[model samples]
Target: MSPTKTSVAELSGNGQLVYGCDYNPEQWDPAVWQEDVRLMKEAGVNLVAVNIFGWAELEPSPGTYSFERLDQVLDLLHANGIGANLGTGTSSTPAWLTTLHPEILPESAAGVRAWPGGRQAWCPSSPRYREYALRLVDEVARRYGTHPGVRLWHVSNELGCHNALCYCDVSAAAFRTWLTARYGTLDALNSAWGTAFWSQRYSAWEQILPPRITVSTNNPTQLLDFHRFSSDELLGYYQAEADVLGKHSSIPVTTNFMVAAHIRNQDYWAWAPHMDIIANDHYLDHRLEDPTVELAFAADATRGLAQGQPWLLMEHSTSAVNWQPRNIAKAPGQMLRNSLTHLARGADGLCFFQWRASVQGSEKFHSAMLPHAGTDSRVWREVKELGHILEKLAGVAGTTVKAEAALVFSWEAWWAYDQESHPSSDVRYMDQVHSLYKALWENGITVDIVAPGSDLSGYKLALVPGLYLVREQESAALADFVGSGGHAVVTYFSGIVDENDTVLTGGYPGAFRDLLGVRSEEFLPMPPGQLLPLDTGATAALWAEALRLEGAEAKASFIEGHLTGTPAVTRNRYGAGNAWYIGTVLDPQALRDVVAGAAAEAGVAVQVTAAGLEVIARSDAEHTYTFLINHSDDEHKYPAPGYELIAGEEVSTAVVIPAGTVRVVRSFSSAPPTTGRISGLKDDESD
Candidate 1:
């Protein structure tokens, strides 16, 4: 079901906002389960995800099953007025299954088999593994399908999170079957892959193999197709399980998406439409230059995946995560700030990775809603406080976020751009994406992170950064967006190739040469630290394109470099609207200037741009709900005329947001509701 049909209210299953956490009862004694329920009710937790990794516990033997403990857990939750987000328990295979069928174990590119001690140790394409998993799913759904305690049916937990790519013979055969369906014949497959090079043309379907352990560099097109196949293969597996659940239940089903900065194996655009309610798992990656900024970016990106519907925060840490080299605990109020940031975007449900901290395991140190320090800890107090706050803001459910601007993103482009051969090693795809996104983010210009080829008619401006792969429809959609009077800002390295990994031969940036009104013959990637001076008082580094403008006029030129007097930036009056082309990497200040100028020309206005103050709004036809977050050490005040939801007070001029705190207000202002999704975009748009 789409978000339009299944709103956040429907997802709540109890007419209240969802405050949830992943609960592992099998890890504890039955005595602890009762106490956990008491704490959950006190914390306003209405939903709990259970049996995520309960395969071994559910079915200990081949045909024998155990339901006593699960039945008890579900009954306990139902009696407490809490709904269960029931997992199919197919996340990881059990040692019993793997020991009987070792052939089902996944193999690495080097042909090393994955061991059973770890999760997701089976190959995705193994038929025997699928058979055994589906049997469990059928039994679980039959028993709990009509149970009043069930809120949503959760598919396998975080599909393709750990073992996305498998190089076993089972996967190889599956890949061959997938290719035949895609290309029909070996001749067509060879042509699409450009296998004519290096005398690698295939004459038979049996000659093909996955791009694994190549002598030198593997075929780029083959590698790209393998990635596409891998994502599809996993989606097929998810659909198979979802089909079984659909047969036995009326409940909606979903799997948590790994849309964080560090996870890229699965392309969520291909997975979004399949979800009943898009849920995401995000852990703050300290390795990022700025983890907090990336956290906000991830939330917006997940909203984009849901087309702006209310999603669930499936798993987030209370403080420090178990992973990462240097795990640092969060500050006094950082947890509150982080949780509210997600809520400010589009999350209707706030949940953590766990209910209680594990005492032993690989993730023993992972932060949970109830930490190992017990109820005396600060984490537990804040967890309860957040639950109370959620209860107060029940009216915010089913409301949609509004944005007049969009940032175009593509997972296919990321896969291709991250390939071994590129202009420069330092020129990463997300770097450009972050640079543009941060500029819009800091300026308070709310943006919907959209996939390519979407309907741009609803947006005033579209920001395209480093989308290296452009299919026929995607290319035409961008052209139509600009021709139909929508402003566009396109960065370099975008539109360089087609879906088949074929370089457009007429000129560089083959896919969008005419739309950009510029032609490039070659890419001039600079040294790691080399900087080229520009006429606009900005320095360029990492990448510069050797180009010639046919109709576009130069906005900035390289003042000193090998390509002196060449165009660094160009502007084209394509149609009723304008398209700005960036041919080289620009500094943060320069990039922000370009983005700001384009936003201004497009008539996009912001509510606030104060430093350390972030403002986001969700609305219906009658009222607007504004979330004000203060990330700085000092307090800040902003004009917001409405009733404060948390404090139940009315405000006239401004609301004072305390340092490291958040405030949500139900404004008296009236705004139009969304059309396609609460994401505020059109319905006809797709990836």
Candidate 2:
């Protein structure tokens, strides 16, 4: 990826697909800055995020600012014809500020203060922290508000990635304030919290504290509200920072989101509206049972945040991440598969965690586009090759992901599932969500990971996987989906609680009992390694139920179990569509059959229809680009729709994508035009 020192003229991608990476020039010598941009240009890189953790460098002391190094970096990028995604440099609190005002530091659930060795050490609700952070942001915006290379503003890096839940006194005060606004009256708060139990009623706002380390289990509703209040406080921090940027800059503002599996704090569905462009940071945790499926799920979740619009892949690893247990490096061709997978799902901009691998710090072992092995490494070659492929994907920039099914993905439900008491400790929310998504993916169906209560009109099928908490309005929407001819499958442990974590009174699966045309009396959570056989030959594990069907017919009944002859899976004819219910967690293979059955009932066509072969299409009004990725070890033969973009071959016959490789074809045209860029600030909007 060595550059030829070409004085290339550039216009900031000029409608081409975005190729970017997080750049950390402060780690290297100033002399290397020249070669960094030169190589970036040679690799077809159009954007570089700068100064993400530059707080200490920018302001070495209070009221003293320095931007000499950042100036050189941005100038080099501008000279090399690359756009700059300028960071606010407030992601981490400087040691000086923390030392002066230690009250800004966050406290853990156990009341231990988080030290400064880690990033995001400040409390989200700390006023002193906000004062210092916003001051730095305002200075930086005033300095580079209209810089030609600046295309976007990167607000506080991966907000709440580390310190989302703080149990400090400041947070307690802020939580009380948020509660006052939410409940409006103390009596209403007491009633909603169900304080009649254990004499937990509140007399005044001052008596309330965060659900910290308690002698016994804290009230579930209190814990839920604390999670809710924490998310709102984090969002409030971003809004305040973004408002500062808006005061001085007109360029669109953005913050990288942690939309992956591990992070479950902020409700992105609520935060998506504040951004000009939604962006997300995803790192492969190959340690997961299935990382590939998780990748697609996260990407689709990000696109869902944008309402099916093309968004940015703000950060992902080139190969291995440093934080995982084994830190397994990706094999040959796997990088291409991972990058193109995100693009296929709807990421217009493809960027890694970093441009160059770090030589110092804790993340020095983390893989980057340019590894420590330099340009001679396979990662470097793949980075350049990915840049070239992105150039070919220029037509895909404005295209949006196409999906026929909507998987109800709710953050509130996730937060509620944090309860210490549940039917089975093994019945994880992610397990159900991932299994359903994996089933759909293995069968070549792409699903939009949408929040509950979203419009179900466009989707033919809806899958609710462990929606433990649903608002009354959300329950109505799912009912309306079935009434309006949309097929739905509700799994066990779903629809039991409302938004406040209050159990629905009538039956076990309270909210949807009538809609499901069934009633359950008790939970029959299975012991570890226990398996129950169904009459239809499918096996269920981890859960079972004691129930009786009211109107729905049994699709499969338990043949040999504690609840023998009971309806394990039931299908109810509800209005124009069918509503199916699974009373237990079926094995992955069995779950696939159930999901396929629902899809067939809804007439949703499976794409590749083969295991390990993922086919998803991103289409515009003019044409569609189909991405065919072979994650399996064997080659695949797929009928070509049009010319293969990556290979640059006219595929009149079937295209053979070898093991661990990916291919894209310009498929069906005239779906819909999804081409629109967020307009920049007006002239008067500039600093």
Candidate 3:
């Protein structure tokens, strides 16, 4: 049966704030429902995510069911006029199920079968597991199908906690089935995995084995297939729950996703076609102040999953989280500031990691709306204030934001890097992608984090950093994108392998050599503290690709290294556009120069010129909203002239915003023109 349509176009009837946080009333007494509703209303919360982990409470026995407490909670929320995001509560199964069916237990990478203790302990490939979970979901839907408070449906929470691998017999059988469907025969599978090298030729599907602890070699092709198998296994689990929910409920359904999570590839794109709305959690290390780069990257990634449709910011920290080394509370306005930043990017809704602080558990110290000290705390006050503001700015919800540039981020490359038996251990995939993201954000370029196969037709420029794995089809797509007048900037060590992590037999950069216009014979790994001076009078560090020019022209060269005078950067002109190759990791200045040059060639507009300041714009057909935030610890000046949205005043002079402050500016103008140069405007200018 076709899945139910739960897309934004269908569910977002009104552009209002869909306010709520994950609620675990099962942990509290049902008698406290009245006070909980009052507190929620006081905080302007209209939506509550319920039953996220209540499987044990709902179904204590295999057939026995209890809905007395759940019904009361639902009735209370409905009476208080708060909407509900109903969860299937299958994230954590009951102890009885695991005891009765031990086969439902998951197997770890070490081939050790995990006992049922924490959540996500069930084997996704087990028929008994799917049968019970599907039945529970069906029961919930049949009971709450027409509930007035139910506004949305949420499936299994954070679905792949076991990292999607299973070495159990059931999973091994399922893997054979999946391989048969994918390759149709053992010969095709053997050839695809390059099994000839290890003398591991498969005679039949039954001979095939999952990549468990028994496999220890550094075979990229084997590891890649295993990762793919894991992702597909988890997808089946998500689909199983979704299929049942779709059959009975008209409400939209979604599960929270992690940003740039390497375990899942463009698999989310296929899963996106099933979800009505996409939601994800955002958590960064405390050492990083401006997670704007990561947040924007996530917003774009999730939006790409739904084909540029807006997504929900399902979980973010209201203040300090206990998981980090130091649980530092957000200084006064930082929580509200970050929430607006999500909205400024592409988020339609804002919700925290939790509603109430856990009294006891691993997450006991995590930040929440109601702290352990009750409603009289600073965190509580800040939450209430932000909730009030969201109620006021409900009109800004569902507005579309326009981006001029896009970044090509692929999870295939992520897997390829992890599988690389490389000479250097310091090279990381996420770090490189983050570097490019930071550069774009620092330059005030609105970037869309895209998958390998996304359409680059709408974007003027696309930046792909550390593209180690470029599948044959994706290579063709990139060529087509550039061939049709789109500028692309690709870095070194890219296009070296295929989707299965098998290296292409040709010279380095494999399928992308012609498009990038350079051939590399060897990768020169520089010693620590060594620097390669560029012809642009800039220095680069770490590794450099020794290149043989093909159809490209050199833009920059190394001056002092053994490969001196060799091209450090090259440009190749395609049909109507150009592809630039960066051969080494450069200093910030060198990277800025190279990226700026490409941006200029593409004619992509910069949104702001101020350093340490972020500019984001969201608009509808009639109005435009701009957010200018100062993330630095000291005061900063905003040079661009514009009218302030919140204050309703036109700025003829520079405005000085103190550290960690933000200003909202709304314009009636169709587009806010921007200059690319970094302004030398001082923070004390308003004095």
Candidate 4:
């Protein structure tokens, strides 16, 4: 069965905002279940994700099952107005199952099998594990198939969190089989992997093993393929469980994804189509000097993963999370700001990790809807207020964010660009992408994060940051997009390699050279603390390409460096439009200038360029909802006058968005929302 692209709220038993948290009734005594539901009603939680990590409780002994406690929990939730986002308890393997069938456990890269105590300890290719998982899912679906309280079927708790890759013998066999299916023959595999370079030729399928830690550096292509295989292996598990649940129940099936820059195990673009509605688990990187920008980036990227379909915010923190070294509590209104930010980016449902704080567990320190301090805490107050706000903003459910610009974000490129053998070890993919994204974000120029194959028709300008891996079709699409009057910015290190991690040999950037109209022979990397001056006054640092313009005119040139007279940035008039090639990593201000200039050329306006405010726009057929959120400690004035949604007043002037507050304004719209999605961009647009 294929997954349908339906809205979660529509598919949900109730059509209200899905305000909920992860409910673990098994963690506390069954006596506490009633109190939990009572508190849930007070907080306006309509849905609760139940039994996510309850594998041991569901199957205490091998082939022996008990749903007694879960039954009571479900009944109590149903007795109240709350419904269950039912989870199949397959996230963790029961100790009994591991004790009886230890072969199901996953082996790490060092070839040591993970212990049974941790969650996600099973290998993806283990037949016994799959057999046990399918049985558990079948039982859960059969019992909850027609239950009024069951709103959706959750396949597993964060897929590929721990055991994303296993270098076990089972995985080795599976990898060989996958290679055979992909390459068809050993000769094809050898040619694609470029085995002749290191005399690492494979004569037979059995010779290939996972690119584990070798004596020196393992083959880069082999490691890249292994990353692809590992991601696909984890995705295969999700597909299998989802297929089983689909067969047994009518509820929409989904798995929560940790869709952030830190979690790189699964390529969610491939995993998104398998889910009925995209659901993500995002935790702010507290280590970041400011985590708000990171949060916005994740939300935008997740919205892109949904292909414009409304997704669910499966989990976010109420305050500090348990895993970070310094778990700082959120300030008074910061929690409300965080949740609404996701809503502004197209999240139809807002939920968190656990419903109540755990007194004793690995996640005991993690904050919940009702924290460890009970219901009297500020966290609880904010939770109640956010729930009320979501209830009131029901009309924002099906609306979509519109942007004349897009930032190209590819997971395959992320994997390829960050490999060990890159030209410069200092090059980080996400940092570069964020530099451009943050620049546009600060300018209030909303951008949709798009993959290589996504539609470029709606977006007048597309920004490609460090696209290290370029597929054949992807290159052609960009070329076609430019030839037909679409402006683009192809940054440094883009179009260097193919889908198989093979370099395009003629010049530095292979397929994009013609479109960009530049040729580079060598890379000039600056030492730490060194900056190369550009004509734009903003310095370039970390990386500089020795660029020679072909058909393009030099927009900016390096003022100092070995290639001091060479072009640092070039602009080419391709067909009806133009493409800008930034040959080096520019400083923040320089990137902003370059991007802003391109955006201006494309007629994309910078709505708000304030320091601390984040402005995003969502639209329907008649009205545009512009959200002005103040992330800074100081107050910010709203630059435009419109009817404020939260304040319920018309602000003609002097509208100050308070610190850590969000103000959504409903104003008249002249244009409709952008039509079609990145996935459906191949369909021609009349406009």
Clashes of 3: 1
Q: Quote the lDDT for 476 in model 1.
A: 89
Give per-residue CA lDDT, model 2, range 1-687, as digits (tens).
111111111213587678889999989999998888888887888989999999999999999999998988888888778999899999998899989998999999899998887899999999999999999999999999988889888998999888899999999999999999999999999988999999999999999999999888889999899988998898999899899988888888889999988899999888898888888999887768989889989998888888887788889988999998899899999889988988888887888889989999999999998889999989889999998898887788777777788999988898888589777788888888888888888766778888899889999999999999999899899999999999999999999998878999878688999889999999888788988888888888888878899999999888884688998899999999999998998878788888889988998865333456777778877788878888888766676547899888877656667788988888557543211111112223211
lDDT of 4 by residue, 1-687 (tens): 232377767633467567889988888887888788888888889889998988889888767889988888898888897888889989988888889899999998788888888788899888889998999888888877888888888888887888888899999999998899889999999999999987999998999999877777778778888888988988888889888888877877888988776888788878888888889999888887557888888998888888765789989989989998998888888888899899888888899987898999789999999898988889999999988887777767777877788888888888888888667889889887877787777666778888886779888999999888999899888888888999999989999999899989988778899998999998877676888787778788888877898999998998874677899988999988899998888887788788878888887775443566777767788777777777778766654456787877786743567777988777777754322111111112211
lDDT of each: 0.85, 0.85, 0.76, 0.82
Q: What would the per-residue lDDT of candidate 1 be over residues 556-657, giving only the tens digit for each residue?
A: 899875698889888888788888988888988888788878887887863334567777888866778888777888776766667888777787756777
Give the TM-score (vs. native) of candidate 1. 0.96
Index of the highest-TM-score prediction: 1
Using TM-score as the measure, name the better of candidate 1 and candidate 4. Answer: 1
Q: If ranked by lDDT, best first, what sequence of candidates would result?
A: 1, 2, 4, 3
Q: Candidate 1 regions off by >4 Å? A: 1-5, 606-608, 671-687
Best by lDDT: 1
lDDT of 1: 0.85
- Order the numbered candidates by TM-score, best leading: 1, 4, 2, 3
Model 3 agreement with the true structure over 346-420: per-residue lDDT tens digits: 777888878888887788899888888889888889888877766555656656667667788766577778554
